[model samples]
Target: MNASADPLVSIVIPVYNGSNYLAEAIESALSQTYSNIEILVINDGSTDDGKTERVAQSYGSRIRYFSKENGGVASALNMGIEKMAGSFFSWLSHDDLFVSEKIVRQMDALAHAASSESICYSNYYVFTDDPADTVPISLKGVPPEHFRYWLTVENVLHGCTLLIPKAAFTTCGTFNTSLRTTQDYDLWFRMAKKFAFVHVPEMLVKARSHAHQDSHKLAGTALKECDALLSGFVAQLGIDELKAGSGQPGAVSYARVAASMRSRGFVEAGLVATKLCIKHLSGESPYTKVLALFVLTRGALMQYITKPIKGLIPPSVRSTIRQWLAGGTKKGPPGAETVRGMGLKEKFSEVYDKNIFRGSKSRSGEGSDLVQTAVIRREMPRLLRELGIKTLLDAPCGDWYWMRHMDLPVDRYIGADIVEALVAKNREEFGSEKIGFECIDLAEGELPKADLIFSRDCLVHLSFADALKIIANFKRSGATYLLTTTFTARTSNEDLGTGFWRPLNKQLSPFNFPAPMLLINEECTEGLNMFTDKCLGLWKLQDINLQ
Candidate 1:
């Protein structure tokens, strides 16, 4: 096991009732351009569809199959890692796919960097079937100085896209089996504390989004886990240390939890939490006021009762309680209006105006960077330039900041979004003549053509089928280069925030595209790969001819 020897990249795929996509995920790994790879598919107690034997047999001798009673994904991953003989270890979710060059690219990057670098990851694309059709975007690279800071706030590495040296496992310990959620985030956070991180700006993986995925369900449980993890970290490392390592803690963590609950129809619990958050900000002492209010609220109390009651109190009574909750609902769900009415355009505007574009002077004297605008300004130029595109069509361009910050020629920019207000604002700022803004619904109409079709962080809300149709539409638009960012399958219950967790439909299938497709690159950003596996990368259109 000499460090200089040819490193064996062991791909550990943990499967649990993921039989449907298991073949695709395994095929994606075996198809990797990098040679000297081993596939270990650990089946974690799948009882529903006993396709484990069939799946293992399909791969023949290429994949080693291990069947164990239904332990969680983390347990299965740990089992695979323990048995892995490769110098570099990477894990892919059974439902997720990877670009052929993912391992090779990451291995090369790791070999070139200093040995002290604990982990290296590349960008990835999030594939969905959503027809609402928002563009995908990636987070800009954080300075080495800010690496620890970025990681503490969120997991910047996606497990599926991550390649960690064996040494990292020795130092960081195994994934926390007790943690049903946030295990990857916890592992990466611990890794960052001890080692430097490197980023490869390539689309190396595709995190499949579908109905049966864990992220769609168990959002509340995931949120609770994340909050516990964060609180634990704060206690162990101290809030000052966390703030020093990561940037200031924004409202996203809390906001996500609240949003998750609302989406799951836990309206009252979500609202109570939101009010508590507001109260805490408003100088409410003893914060117990919020907790007290939550306990007293009928909705919150019902939520507390439903879990145990459903399990112990019998199905007949549970159904009655559910009916009652639905019937007696007051004050609606948290962020419901925000969720229903706000499209990608509106949400982006809210995030931009309230946070990113606020023109808040940098206290650190790092330039007049708006927190939100800084990520776009620094990353867009390089990303666009790397795509070798002079022209870009920013579909559903919420605010024109992406266009504004891009260094491309004025005539090359075209912006279309559903928000008329934002579209009008864009016309006023960039002038309707130079930058074209259209009020278009990608779901219903035709899209404008361009060299590269760019979108960012816009998929999750739609169903899987709709996401695929959107991609199909993108291909039809005659765009050669497609760049987008999305969440990974590793999303935890905590990651969903307050959103009610729904398990992904087990029957949901992967998007099928013709071959000779070039998957340019993929990476994980946004603290952790909870919701989606990988983020940020350039992809070449393969199956569709953009003529």
Candidate 2:
């Protein structure tokens, strides 16, 4: 197509501390088959090696290079938009690549779209350092009315795949610089409300995933911003009875957003968001309101009630009582005996004193303890050394049986349990200048700071509500890593009543733990005839992404 026949398309490349992949991204933009195109590189004050500036200069007049004070990705893109000479605007990240026909394909798709459609986006591929991990992602185009509702729930459109008409910004406005991570999402959400979005079925972009991406580093801030942005939009679209004559999509969307927030450890914010969801659903959707209220109450009780109850009891009595009441006692089958309607501490304390319960059947040193102890001894030292963990806290240090066998490699190690008797025994048995023991009620007491925390066979014993509180406390304690044995199975979550024993994949499902956990090693007590998939997993508190 001739230059005049085809409208000029401006590609804005926002450069940050991404010199490592800047050249590759620029080459892809410059090599596009679409002739009527201009490439603009906006340097947002990168303090990395001077390679980014030098590389831009190497392109010379072929591409326009603009530098400004360090604002952020949104600021750089806004500046580029201000100086763009093309009628259509598209953003290309410094680490993402555009196929040679990406611009041409989008323009062709735009020809078929309605005049009101101001944005055209195509399917894209996600790739990491490993080529085998690359996969194509597709999105279905929806009408403006439903698109706004979709964006409120989540961002499905990739910014790199979008080509926005210059006129769209007049009504939709430019990127919000105040937002660090959700700038693209926020802008897209706003634009979707006013303009229709057309999705091209073809995959034309390669979005790279790496460790240094802003989304990975600033997850918590991004989640808060997303919540704030969604809250504003949902509030503006009031759910008055006249407006929502039928079922209210706004209320459903808000409920989904609230659930997402809760899954990410934003418990308080999740409750507030859910309340708004319930308000919108009040007169519109009776069934939805009931479900939302149930979810909200369950989550609230888990964090507020169950968590505090666990902590109020001494650690020594905590595990013993739970085991005794649950009938997981190694002594024998618990029979029809029950410990309900009694004081938790008093009943459990009497049971512990009388040796009514030997211990949790799972932890009863019936030779299975040797296997767990050996694994801990083999793994703990290497993990501490590799992760640079200086201090360690072992919660629910159940009798300190297996711990006594492990080699303590950390600079300092502390064993803690709710059982005062167990803590005293541990201190008498192993306390030293480097090794110490404390009586800690994990569910309720203040936790000491440590580089790493090891929680084993604890969460399964508590209700799902109490487990979430303890996990939240672990994050708040400023611990870098969390090591725990998660009980996962092939089937659905097993309801142990107070807490549900989940499959490995469901680990992230309960209470939106702060970080995504890594399954470092799987230990099957199968040799001992156990029916649980007890695997040791590691979670890096620093690596949990906001989304």
Candidate 3:
């Protein structure tokens, strides 16, 4: 802890209106076990009736105080960087506290690391009001190579946990001021690219997660600005032949941002993001660019076709015609009963091929494709927006034809299906930062949690027993709502030669489910003319009071 022998560490606390906990944050840094530490509090124009300024003034000469005009956190940090008198830099937020031994342990790790340029960070504890609520976090299995990939998906690194060498700043530069929420994330990515980040898997800081934090206040606008900053960062990476399409790191990030924008009704922003992705990916993925344009055009055609078709034929007649064309009385497909008893994974793998929807028959809604593309394109997004759903789990995302065009007002989209090849192709071609694909057998495996579970025309293809099991899984999946279209004939579960068909109401009947744990309320969709009895049921689960 000798000042002359040890590297001087600067603990910069950036504050705005953080009068409540600023003193506590400052004291924690001053009491650090590593004595050769300088504490600098940057007051980024606090308008809290001079309260924050007073708090810093009370610290006086013990902590260096600098007051600047109202600037963002990035600017305050940059100012601190310029004035810091230490070779090692650490960011201690005005609301967060550094453990007494945080620096001592980090320095010990760096000494062993033997790399002058290596950045060191440690796990931290997240707490609200109660000490019992503290959760120790350790980022496991995260080496430097995988760090970039994991960071691209989401920012996992905690800011206060970081202990950066001054050389890293000189090499990678400081935070981006334009970025609101993800400035720390941007800086991490920049430094990670050039320097190795050594992880200390021990809790070295106490991060406060409170209501008044900047992140919580600007929650809605944060993602939009973060994506904007990320788009610019990726653009600067300069795509190469080796970095095209999903393989291109920058392209992958852009596509994800675009998908999120599109899902949230920011069509123009999404289009711009898509354009950026195409620009980076076009050099190596010419077909992918063409495919994007083709999907756009096909969406327009489907929208137009469905409008006229809806007007010409009544929905009931359309339903009747569809049934008759499949030979009306067929008992299901040839091996329907055999497939019914098969395991969900094997059954879907054998029957639903990767390119099943690419076939002309599936595209034109021939057999088993009960919900029309028009219904999905027109109704689904509106329904999602109306329900204020921000996350969606679309199982059996078949070709994802209608979804590409729909204005789904969601923040996250996960496509899960039983088809392995289809899931792989989706991961390769369409996976982005906010969008992902997983191969899951609905009857056997657990479903991802979301605000809504969207499975249309999928459950009806299963036998009554298997379908019931799937329903039970959905209830256990912690989803609030299920938006699904069930094939109904006011009858019991029967083999209609196309697959298993059952009455929509009967399947969702409260009496059919287990007691006390599940309370399902079903409401049919109105204004859906075609296949009127082919009802869209919104089933809401109260909760699963698991005994």
Specify the highest-lDDT model's number: 2
Evaluated at residue 91, the lDDT of candidate 1 is 90
Ranking by TM-score: 2, 3, 1
Candidate 1 lDDT over 349-458, as tens digits, reads 45444443223352111112343333344345544654567678876576654345445542477887766676787788786555677777665558887888876544
Regions of candidate 2 where Cα sits further than 4 Å from its true position: 130-133, 238-257, 264-273, 277-547
* Candidate 1 ranges beyond 4 A from true positions: 1-5, 129-137, 155-157, 237-547
User: 1 or 2: which has the higher lDDT?
Assistant: 2
Better of 1 and 3 by lDDT: 3
Q: What TM-score would candidate 2 get against the native?
A: 0.57
Distance from true location, Cα of 538 in model 1, Å: 35
Residue by residue across 301-404, what tens digits does model 3's lDDT show?
32222221334544444334433433443344334445555666776665555332223545312322333454344345545765788889987776565566
lDDT at 378, model 1: 36
Task: Report the poorest 10 consecutive residues by lDDT, candidate 3.
Answer: 514-523
How large is the C-alpha RMSD of every model relative to the true structure?
A: 15.6, 12.9, 17.0
Error of 1 at 543 (Å): 44
Lowest-lDDT window of 10 residues in candidate 2? Answer: 301-310
Q: List ranges where model 3 is wrong by over 4 Å.
A: 233-547
